[model samples]
Target: MSDKTSEAKVHFRSNAKVHEVDLRIREANVRLCQLCLWRNRKGIGFHIAPSSSSLPVICMVESNSPASAGGLKICDAILAVNNKNISEANYQQATTIIKTALNTKGRVDLLVVEQKFYKELKKNDISMISSSAKILVTPHSMPADFFNFPKHQPRTCDIHVNQDNKTFGFEVVSGDDNIGIYIQEVAPDSAASNAGLRKSDRIIEINGTYIEQDSNMNYQHYLWIAQASVYVDIGDDKSKLEATKLFEFVLYENPLHDNARLNLAILHFNPSHVHALETCAIVGLQMNHPTEAFIDLNQVLHFQPSSAPLLANRSVIQQFLDDNRNQSC
Candidate 1:
């Protein structure tokens, strides 16, 4: 028994060493890129979302931005900025770190796990999605039943305001051809702003009733038809030509789903809107995205350091995560 135990211990130690070496090699392979952005002028021009327990992901990289020029891509996990560890930082903290690095040095060094590697990690585990890739709005597998529905239901969010004014500080405009209401502005320090309302957010519904449009056809119908058309392989040349034509009509013309985009947008916004973060965390938990929930909870704790409820909720999430890890092992 003693000999077997000793052998097992030796095997464990060897495995640990191998893991450490692999990690070091992976880190070394991650391209160390640099970018210079004017201080307080224009941002690095990328948006980030919180991961479950690892680095925040690059959700959006603007075209022609410093981050874009620096070879940053969507779904990249930002490992560090200027040697400052961001692996465990929340979205706000990661952005702040990058901004500070840019302000102080006029240039920032980023260590990132590129999208390809991140996708590989995701394939190994579902929880890895939070750490390795941006949350996609659409599912990889589209259900055939989805085609039966004329349109998806609009999502409504109730945000509590603890201020004197009851107004949600946002302006709306009719979408092109009066399709839906589009958020035109979100006033800073207002309830709407705190609720994570953004400019250009299309409001499909308010309270419960769908926003009516003058157009008889729903925009989403066109989008749905377009997506469904891709699978119309009738094994005939004429049918294939028709499918191609249908695809052309819907290509580059899909109306964004309000729910998924809103969830992502709110979760990614900086300056950490406590109410929005709390709501987002609840949504994340409901969606089985505990990593996203944990990230939001951590961000809220940063603002409300002494809130018992937040701390308790975070403890629950942590426990759940621990349980998940143990089960996975």
Candidate 2:
């Protein structure tokens, strides 16, 4: 039994050493490949120095993998993974070997290096090795979807306060993580929709500040600006902030249903905003008063006669009103 235990200890120690070496190499390759994927998506690439002291180049990426989608070609040498650098001495076999092992675990890391995209292979600064590194995957295959990826740009529009003094407009931003300000579908009769706000119009900013970049300012900065500018104005609620808190609670109850907060927020800032006028039209339509909706639609048309969507909506409302009038007549 003592002899058997001694043998098992030796084998375990040997395996541990091998795993350490393999892990180091695999880590480097994964970093390189990940960076390559990012560069491809962003239209940029990087350069690396090949030194004898560096880790061995890991398993070259096969073409047609996610890395290849990012333009990594076959047989590209991996140099790093996830920001960890690798050298020729330690990583050449580390990546694939690690990948094979990770297949059992369902995940693996890779670092890859390749000839500069479309450039001739170059010699290492020290050993003059022709660098054949390439990341064999694309951005979509990164372990984490958000790793090293660029975010979508914010969307903004021009609020024509006057012919020459237009101010930038944005949708009311929402959500945690400071990801973006989304103008969920504009309410048909809300101040925003009535003022020509369209669905999917990403609210980028009010006056050029990135309110979406910080969760704390989504309401205070951008929403406040939109309301103040009369683009969205409801009525002066001296305790509007408190009212909003209550509104948040109400919204939380439904969770998925659209809340009245957006419309109310705009109205709170600019009660006379034309968009608010359209909200009245929507209410009229819901109440079976097509004529009332037509009146509200006409009120907005008086402001923006050339708005096509509004015109279309108005035409539909007008038809409804005319049919009702005929019935009444």
lDDT, candidates in the order shown: 0.58, 0.45
List, in order, the clash count of every candidate structure. Answer: 1, 57
TM-score of candidate 2 to 2 decimals: 0.22
Predicted model with the maximum TM-score: 1
Model 1 error, position 244 (Å): 10
| Model 2 stretches astray by more than 4 angstroms | 1-237, 255-269, 275-295, 306-309, 321-329
Candidate 1 lowest-lDDT run of ten: 133-142
Q: For candidate 1, write residues 185-215 as lDDT tens digits.
A: 5678887767755444566555444655623
TM-score, candidate number 1:
0.31
RMSD of each: 26.7, 20.1
Off by over 4 Å in 1: 1-32, 38-41, 50-54, 83-85, 114-224, 227-329
Error of 2 at 320 (Å): 2.7
